[model samples]
Target: MSEQNKTWCPNIEFNETDEELILKAELPGVKIEDLIINAQTRFVSISGICNPDKSTDEKEVIPSQFNYGQIKCNTPLPVAIQPEKTRAEFIDGVLTISMPKLRVASAVNF
Candidate 1:
């Protein structure tokens, strides 16, 4: 199939703590340079491209279920976050993003 015609979705997990929110995405065979991440106060978006291995050999056709090409995911945060403080890392085909929650002061009555 043509590279432009293929599309795939990566598995993702989102979690939140009292101090921060965490997002994890499983992307096999995807390079770090091909990833793009955008974070806002209330949402996060991830996009990337995964290319299939190129081979120049004559072989018989076989049935396979591997996905390639563009991938995109947009998820809303459970709470307000500090997008400026967001941090991310990619390891072993897995991406982990950590975002600190925006702290709001509580009202006090004397």
Candidate 2:
């Protein structure tokens, strides 16, 4: 944890208009294939491995803020979500996920 980014909380947001729950994670220099997404009946989990020294595969001789280890976060879903109806993309160093919220029907009489 750095002095500047010591107050960062990675979580998902529910966009009512979009009718989907979006999850945003700040993972600098994370590869697409290194990330893993798993969705269950009422929850979703995302995790990725970060290797700051992967490009060279050389021995690391120093430690710094850039050194980020495995990151994984499991978020509880508000509504049932289709496991197959999920999309993820990586841009720069952030990961964006869009999940379509499941719809539950209710019977009402007028």
Judged by lDDT, which candidate is best? Answer: 1
Superposed on all Cα atoms, model 2 deviates from the true structure by an RMSD in Å of: 5.4
Per-candidate count of clashing residue pairs (backbone under 3 Å): 0, 0
Q: Mind giving the per-residue lDDT tens digits that candidate 2 earns over 1-110?
A: 54223322344455534477777777776688978888776888877676554556666476465535666678887777767888888898777778787777889899
Tens-digit per-residue lDDT, 18-103, candidate 1: 89899999987889999999999999998889877757684527744666788888888889899999999999999999999999
Q: Report every candidate's CA lDDT.
A: 0.87, 0.68
| Clash-forming residue pairs, model 2 | none
Task: Give candidate 1 misplaced runs (Cα > 4 Å).
Answer: 1-4, 58-60
Q: Which stretches of model 2 miss by more than 4 angstroms?
A: 1-18, 54-63, 108-110
